[model samples]
Target: MSTSRFLPALRVMLALQTVALLLQAITAGLLLSTPGGRGLHNASAGVVLVTALLYLVVAILVWRPGGGSPRAVAPAVAMVVLVLAQAMLGALHMKALHVPLGVLMFGGSLVQLVQVLLARRAVAA
Candidate 1:
């Protein structure tokens, strides 16, 4: 695909990642108060992982040494790492770390999404 298509693709992936993370957070809350919460949370974790991987792939495609910024790659990598760790922590029943990491992931994803959207807008203008 052309370079022009990469940005929009990246943006779509980021948006999906952001939404997946948000759903993870919601299901986490459900996990506490509802009987079926655990299953929902577990399923959402898989969705989050998939979205993170997709985001990483798109981020790499969007990165061009001379034309596109490499900065996006770092956070995309971080998201994958964090999501893996988050899954491990959750599976290990390490709430102390898992909870905080989930929150951090959500916040970071939100920031990344905003940055991508702004970058696209800047390019358009």
Candidate 2:
């Protein structure tokens, strides 16, 4: 019930999200670079799938405004949207869209990281 308690959970979420995001981003990169390669697309999809699942868990932890402030909610929503888009676009696997999709995932991940850092700083103070 204490704000302090949430700090550790938030930190863990941050680390997990960062790892998952990076993996997914890497997968996207791999796919984007090898559009004609089915093997790479499959591998990328696998990574994206796993990372998305992990991201879901992280999303839950930060689902609500822990301190009753809506500061992190926007970025969280953005993350969710990007996650869905990434999954859908990835499933489609259209070669032309690979780069754009990759960019979206990468940008979303960076935003998530920024949000996590901000949340951590809020807790630290």
Candidate 3:
């Protein structure tokens, strides 16, 4: 497969992850504030869920044995694990861990973005 096709998909995944992370961060802040509400929690959870799915799709595409090498397999597995952990944290109302998880999620997305960009550049050259 051409790098251009997969790279853009990867970037879309990263962008989704980034937005999810930001939403989590903001939701964490709101959760810590006065008069707690379920709305914010639900919203954040939804965002995380959607972004996790997006990441999963990207991971699958990248690691697909038929289309590419097994390079992204590890990261894809890690991302799935992270998504589950993050969801668990949310369900358990572990607000303290939200920021940290958001940071980790963002870092993971950044790594994916960098990898995609690098691969695309190499293919272009």
Backbone clash total for model 3 is 0
Q: Model 3 segments beyond 4 Å from truth?
A: 1-4, 34-38, 95-98
- Which number leads on lDDT? 1
lDDT of 2 at 33: 78
lDDT of 2 by residue, 45-123 (tens): 5655555555554454444544433444455556556666766765676546756766766666666667666866776
**Per-model CA lDDT versus the true structure:** 0.88, 0.57, 0.70
Clashing pairs in 2: none
Flag clash pairs in model 1.
none
| Residue lDDT tens for model 1, 56-96 | 88878777632466788899999999999999999999999
Rate residue 13 of model 1 by lDDT: 90
Error of 1 at 70 (Å): 1.8
Q: What is the lDDT of residue 50 in candidate 1?
A: 95
Preferred candidate (lDDT higher): 1 or 3: 1
Model 3 is weakest, by summed lDDT over 10 consecutive residues, at 1-10
Superposed by TM-score, candidate 3 places the C-alpha of residue 116 at a distance from the truth, in angstroms, of: 1.7
Decide which is better by lDDT, 1 or 2: 1
